[model samples]
Target: AKQIDDLTLAIIICLSRLFLHISADSKYYQSFFWIAMSLLQIHDTKLFASCVHFLDQIVHSMSDNGCFRGQGLATFCASARKGPSERMLAKLDQLSGLSFKYDFSFAVAGHLLKGLKNVGTKAAVTRLLNTFVEYSQENNPANVTGYFAAILPHCGDNLSESCRQRLLSCSETGSSVFNAGMVPDKIRASLLFTYLVTILKSSESEHEQLYIYKALEEGAHFMPDCLPVTFDVLMKKMEQILVASQNDQMLTAVLAIMNCVYTYGLESSSPVATLNKQYMESIGFASLGSADQFNQNQKGALIQAVCRVLDGFLQL
Candidate 1:
C-alpha cells in the first residue's frame, strides 16, 4: 500500500509540473492530459486536488487562448466526452468540495457539449449519452452530477424514455448529496429549475411529469428569477400539446406543473404570470378550431383543464 501511495504521489507531482510547463496548444498536452486523467484512478487526497486544479486549468486555457476553437478544443472535448475510467469515477465520488466538484464536473460537461456540436452522427451522440447513464448506474450517481445538470438543459431533446428516467433518478440522488452540504441557495434553486426544464422538454408520459411536479413541490423555494424560464418552458410545452399530439394526460400534467410553479413562484399580478395566463387561454381557444377532430367529452376535458390553470392564476 505504501508503495502504491508513493507511486500515486509521484505521478501527481509529475503531472502537476507537466501541466504548469506545457502550453495549451503543445503537441504533448493531449498525451499529458490523458495520463493525468488516468492517474485519477488512484486514491490520494493530493492527487485529487491536483486533478481538480488540472481541470480548472483546462478551462482557463480555453479562455486564455481562443486558438483552442479548432483542433485543441476538439481533442480535449472528445477526451472529456469519453469521460474518466471507472476507478477514477469511484475516486471522484469519495472526494468532497463544492467548488472543486463543480469545476471538475462542469469542465468535463462543457467539453463534452462543445464536442457534441461537431459530431456528424446521431449514433455517436447516443453512445456518448449512454456512457453517462452507465456511469451513474455503476457508480455513485453524484460522481458526475454536474455533467447531468449541464446535459439536461441542452441534450434532453434526444433522450429516450428509459434514459430520461435514469437521468432523473441520478439527479434526485445528486440533489440529496448536494443538499447535505452547504450548497448555496441560488445553486440549489438553479439545479432544481434545470431538472424541471429538462422534464418539461422531454417528458411524454403523465407518470414522468407527475414525478417532476412532485419534485418541484418538494423544492419549491426557488428564487423569483426562475419565473421567466419556468413560464417560457411551460408555455412551449403547452403550445406543443396544442399543435401536436394533444394527449389529455400530458395536458393535465402541464397544468399540474403550472400550478406548482405559480403557487410557489412569482407575484399574483406579475406581468409574466399574466402574459402566460393570456397565452394559455389563447392557445386553448385556438385548439377549438380543430374541434372536429375531438369528441364532445374530449373538448370538455380540454376546456376544463385550461380553465383550471387560468383560475389558479386568477386566485394568485
Candidate 2:
C-alpha cells in the first residue's frame, strides 16, 4: 500500500512539473494559473513541496522575461534580463483577467506568500503581489477584508523593507485594495486577529496600535460570529496585562475592545454573552481591580469604563 501510494505521488508530481514546463510560455499563462490552482489543493506534503518548486520556477521565468510589466510593478520587474516581448505582454494581460475568479486570486496569493520565504524570489513575489493588488482594485470584491487578510502575511517582518513599504502604500486608507469590515470567514478572521494581537503586543507606535484597535472593533461588532477565537485572543492579552506589568495603553485598548464587544453583542444571544458576563465578574475580582496595583484614580477609570459597557448591555 505504501509503495503504491508513493508511486502515485511520484507520478502526480512528475506530471505537474512537466505540465508547467510545457506551459511556461506567456501565452499559456491561464493554463499555467489553473495548474497552480490545482497544485495548491493537493494534500500530500511531499507532493505539495514539488508543486511549490515548479510554481516558483515558472514565476521566476515569467518575471525574468518581464511578463509582470506595469506602472506600479515596474520596479520589481526591472531586473528582467530582457524586457518582455510586446506579444508576451498582450497574451499575459489576457491571463491576468483570471484574477476575477476568487479562487484564482487567492491561489496566487497563497503561492506568493509561500514564495516570500525564499529571498531569491523577492522580485517575482513582488510582481505577483502587485498584479494581485491591481486586479483587486479594479474588481473590489465584496468580503474584500477576507482577501486582505489572505495576503496579510506580507505585513510581517520577513518582507523586504521596500516591498513592505509598497504593500503599506497599497493598503493605506482610500486605496482600492484596502477594505474595512468584518473579516468574512473564521480562518481569515483568525489570521486577521493573530496579526492584530502581534501588532498590539509588539508595536509601540500609537498610530499602529490605533489601527489594530479599529480592526478589533469591526471584528467585535460581529460578536460570536467571530466568537471564541477573536475574544479568546483579546482575553489572553488582557490577562497578560492583569497578571504581569501595567501598561495603561494596552489597558485602554483592552477596555475599548470590551466596549465594542458589549455594544455589539447585546442582541447576539450567543454563548459569548454568558462568557462575557462571567468575564466581567472575573475582572472585578482580578488583580486588575486591586487598589494596591492601580491607584484610586486609575482604578476608578477602569471601573467606570467597565460600568458603562455593562450598563449598555443591561439596557439591551
Candidate 3:
C-alpha cells in the first residue's frame, strides 16, 4: 500500500533550505546542491518546480534592488560543474537584461556565458562573444571589457583568434571603445598574454603554429608595455622546460618570443620597435668593443636570436 507522508514533505522542504544556504557561499557546494536539486525533481516534481520558482523570485528581487546581494545565487550560477537548463537560462537572461540597464556590472551575464561554456555550448559562446563586441563598442565601459576578458579564455581556438584580432585593432587605434584606464588595459593585456602562452605551451601542429604566430604578432603590435612581462613569464617557463631538455617546448617558447618582438618592431616608429633596439643596446650589442669581451659575446648571441625572430616578422 502506498502511504502518504507529511513528514517526508517537511524533510524535503528543510533540505532545500539547507542546500540553498550552502550554495550561496561556496561555488564548490553548488555542484552538490544541483545534484540534490535534480534528484528532488526526479522524486518529487512539485519540490523541483518549487525550487525553480524560488530561484526566479530571488533573481527578480535582486534585479529590482539593483543589488545581487545573495551569495548563494551568484555561487550557484557561477558553479562551473553545473548544467543550467532552458528555464535556468531564461532566468539568467532576464537577470542579465536587468543588470545591463541598471547595474552595469554585467556580473550575471558573465556567469551565464560561463555556464554556457561549461556546458560546452559552442553556439552560445559565439553568441556571447558577438554580443560582447557590440556592447563594448557601443558602451565603452569597464565592465564590458572585463566581461569579454573573462570569456576569452573559454572560447575555442578559432574564435579566440578572431576575438583577439578585434581587441588588437581596437587597442591600436587608441580609440578603444572600452575604458583606457590602467585596470581595463591591464585586464585586456593579461588575456592576450595568457592566450599566447597557452598556444606556445600546447601547439604541435603547423596549423596551430600559424594561428599562434598571428596572435603573437597582433599582441606585440598592440600592447608594447606587456612585452617585458610576457617575456619574463615565458622565459621562466622555458627555463623549466629546458631543465628536462624538452626541446619541443623550448623551441616553441623561443619562437613565440622572437615573433612577438619582430612584429612589435615592424612599425619603425612604434614604441615596441624602439624598445627592442634598446634591449639589444643594453646587452652591449649596439657597438663593437663597447663592453667586456665575454659580456659582448653573450649579448651578441642574444641579439642574434632576437634578430632571427625579427626576420620572421619582417616577412609578414
Candidate 4:
C-alpha cells in the first residue's frame, strides 16, 4: 500500500509538470492539477520539494491573479500595441531586485519567455530584461547572465528577439536607460565582458570551449548593439584582465576571448588587438626572478604563451 502511494505521487508530479504546458481550459488539465495538489499535501518524501516546485508554477500561471494581470495587460495593449501597462510594468520593475533576493531571477525570466505570446507579456519581459542590463551596469554583474538567458533561447517573433533589437538600437546611441544610482557605463561594459569570458573559461573541454566561445561571440555581436558599449568599452575590459593574469585560468580565457573579438568581435576592426601589448608588460604575467619565488614562477609558461598575443598571432 505504501509503495502504491509513492508511485501515485510520482506519477502525479510528472503529469503536473508535463501537462502544465497544455491548455488550462482543458478538462483533463483541470482534473489532473487538483489531483497533483491534493497529492502534494499527502506526500512526505524528499521529492516533495519538486512537487512543491511544480505547484508554484501552476499557481503562478493558472491563478486568478495571473488572469487578472493578463487581462489588465491585454486591455492596455489593445489599442494596437503601443507599450506595456503601468501595473504590468510595475510588476516587471520589481523583478530584477526581487529575483536576485530569491534566486528566482532565471525562473522569472523563463516564465516571461513562456508567456511572450500572452497579454502584456512582451512588454513585461523586455522591460525587465532592460532593467537587468541597467542593474549590471551598477551592481550585479550576474545580471548579464540573466540578460543572455532571456534572449539566447528559441522563440519566434517574441519578446526576447524584440528586446534584442531594442538593445541593439540603444547600443548605437551610447546612451543609458538606467538612472543615477547605477554604475558607470564603462564599468558595466567591463563587467559584462568579464562574465562572458569567465563562463567560456569554465567550460569542461577544449571542444566544448570552442563551441561555447563561438556561441558567446554570436551573443556578443548583439552586445555592441544592445548596450552603451563599444570596441573601446571592451578594450577597457581586456586591460583589466591583463593586469590580473597571474590567475592562469583567467589568462587562457582572456587569450581565447581576445581572438574571438579580433576575429568575430566586430565588423571592421576591434581595438582589442591593442590589449596584447598592455598584457605583455603587466607584472602579473612577467618576472623579476630575484624578487619573489611565487611572483617569478606563477603561471610562467602561460605568461609566455599569452603575451605572444601582443605579437599579433594565435599560438598552440
Candidate 5:
C-alpha cells in the first residue's frame, strides 16, 4: 500500500513535467509541478529511482503512441543504453547499491553525457561507451550518434579514445548502405546538435568549451558525408544565432567556433565550406536590415565577427 502511494504520486509528477515543459497551455501544470516536488522531498533514493523509471515509461508511451508525431519525434522510447536485468533488479532488492537503475534512453543519455566528466571512475565511463558502441553495431547507427554527440566533447583526449575510435568506425558503416533510416531520423540528430551547442553556450568551463569546439570542428568535416540533414540543422543554428543574438560573449564564442571551422576548411577544403555557404546565403547575412534595433557598438561588434568568418564561409 505504501509503495502504491509512491507510484501514484510519481505518475502525477511525471505528467506535470512533460506537459508543463513541453507546452504552456495552463498554470495548473506549473502549480502541480511544484506541489509534486514538495511532496517528493524525501530521503528515499530507491523510491525516487522507481518514480523516475516510471516517468520515463510514461514519456516513452506518449512518444510511441503518436502524441508528439506532429513534433517529428518518431518515438519517445527512453534511449537507455543498457537496462537492468532481472538479476540486477533482484540485487537492488537485496542491497542498496544504487537507489535505482539509471535510464539510458536517448533523452536521458543527453543529460548523462553532460555529466560524464564528473561521473566517478574511468571504468564506469568506459563501460557505458562500450555498451553504446555495442548497441550501435547491432541497431541503427545514426540513432547511436545522439549518444555520440553527448560523448564526443570528452572523446579523443586520452579520456575515452578507445571507445571514441570504436564509435567512429561503427558510424563509418552505419546500419545500412542506403541509410533509409537516417533520412527520417534527421530531427533527432538536429535536436542533439542543438542540445550540444546550447549546453556549450551555458557552460562556464574554458576547458570543456575547447573540447566542444574541437569536437564540433571535427564533426563539421564528417556530418555532410554521414548525416547531411544534421549538418543543415547545425548551420541553421549558426545563422539564426548570427542574426538574432544580442549577447556579445555568446556571439564571440560562436565566432571563435566559426573561425575554427572556417580555418579548418581553408586548409583542408572540407565540405563545411559548401554547406556553410548555403546556410549563410539562406540567412542573407549581407542584407540583415534588422540591425537598426541594436546600438552602434553592439552592431559593430557583431558585424565585425560576422564579416571575419563570412569572408571565407560565404561564396563570392
Candidate 6:
C-alpha cells in the first residue's frame, strides 16, 4: 500500500508538470500549480530527491527566456517539507548563475525566501538577494523590480541591518525612474506594492512603520487595494497609519480601510479562505469545491487587481 501511494504521488507530480508545460495561459499554468504544492507535502527524502532531479532536467532544456520557469521550479523545491542535500544545493547555485541571464530573478528570490529557515542556506539566499538588489540599483535595469519585490517578503530581523538599509534606500530612488516616463504604470505599481508589502511585513520599529505609512499614503493614490487583509494585529497597524496627522497619510489610512473591507468583508466567507482554495486547486489538491461560494464577479475583480499588479511588475 505504501509503495502504491508513492507511485500515485509520483504520477501526479509528473502529470501536473506536463500540464503546466503545455499551458501558455496563466490560468492553465495555475491549474497545474498543485503539482508543486503536492511535491512540497512529500516527506520521503529519496522520493523528494527524485522529484528535484526531474525538475532540474526540465530546467536544463529551457530556452534563455524560458529559464524563469526553472527558477519557479526551484521555488517549488525550496517550498518542500525538507531542505535540500549538498548536491541539490550545488545545483541551486548553478541555476542561480543562469537565472541572471533572464528575468528569472523573481523566481530565484522566491526560492531564496523559502530556504531562509536554514542558517547556511539562508546566508546563501541573502547573498543572492543582496547581489540582485545591488545589480538592480547600479544598472538601473527594468525587470529587477520583480526580483526585488520577491525579496521583500523575506525581509525582517533575519536580514542584516545593512540589507534593510539598502532596501529602504531603493524604495526611495527606485521609483524615481518609474515615476518618470521610462517605466510603465504597471511596473511602477508592482515595485511600489512590493516595497510597501515588505515594509509592512518587516520588523515593527516605529521609524520603519512611519516610513511605510507615508509611502502607503503616497501609493494609495494609484493602487487602492494594495493592503493585505486586516485582522486583529493588522487592524492595529492600520489604526496607527490612520492616526498620522498628514493628509497624505490619512488618505493611505482610508485606502487601507477600503482594502480591508474588500479583502475580508465577505458576508459568509473570508478572502484568505477563498484565495487558499483557489491556490490549492491550482496546485492540484483534491477539490473541496467550496470556492464557488463567493460571488464570481467579486472573485474575478480581486484576481484582476492582483494580476494587473503582477503584470505591472513584470513590465518593469
Q: Of the candidates shown, which would achieve the greatest TM-score relative to the real structure?
A: 2
Ranking by TM-score: 2, 1, 5, 6, 3, 4
Query: Global lDDT for candidate 4?
Result: 0.36
Q: Count clashing residue pairs per candidate.
A: 0, 0, 2, 3, 6, 8
lDDT of each: 0.42, 0.41, 0.39, 0.36, 0.38, 0.39
| Backbone clashes (count) for model 3 | 2
Give candidate 1's whole-model lDDT.
Answer: 0.42
Per-residue C-alpha lDDT of model 6 across residues 71-136, encoded as one tens digit per residue:
443333333312222233223223222121222343334333333433434444455555545433
Q: Residue-wise lDDT of candidate 5 within 1-316, one digit each (tens)?
A: 1222556556655664565355423423222222222222222333333333333443344444444443322122211112322232223212211111221224334323323433332244335544444332334444555455545554435535555555545544422112234323434433344445544544555555555544454444434332232343345555665798675654665576567555545324333535643432332221111111112333333333323322322221
Cα lDDT of model 4 by residue, 240-276, tens digit: 6578546565456546556655555344553453452
In order, what is each prediction's RMSD in angstroms? Answer: 21.2, 18.7, 20.7, 19.8, 18.9, 14.7
Off by over 4 Å in 6: 1-103, 116-122, 133-140, 150-214, 225-236, 239-316
lDDT of 2: 0.41
TM-score for candidate 6, please give it: 0.35
Give the per-residue lDDT of model 3 (tens digit) for 1-316: 1221566456556754664454344433334323332322221233333433333333433334333243323332343323433234223323222222222323323323323323333344345444444333322334444344434433434445545555555454432322354125643454334434433443344444444444444455567555553453445544554565445744664566566666566323333434533543333222111110112223333333323333332332
Candidate 3 accuracy as TM-score: 0.31
The clash tally of candidate 6 reads 8
Residue pairs in collision within model 5: 78-105, 79-104, 79-105, 79-106, 80-104, 80-105
Q: What C-alpha lDDT, on a 0 to 100 scale, does residue 99 get in candidate 6?
A: 23
Error of 3 at 22 (Å): 26
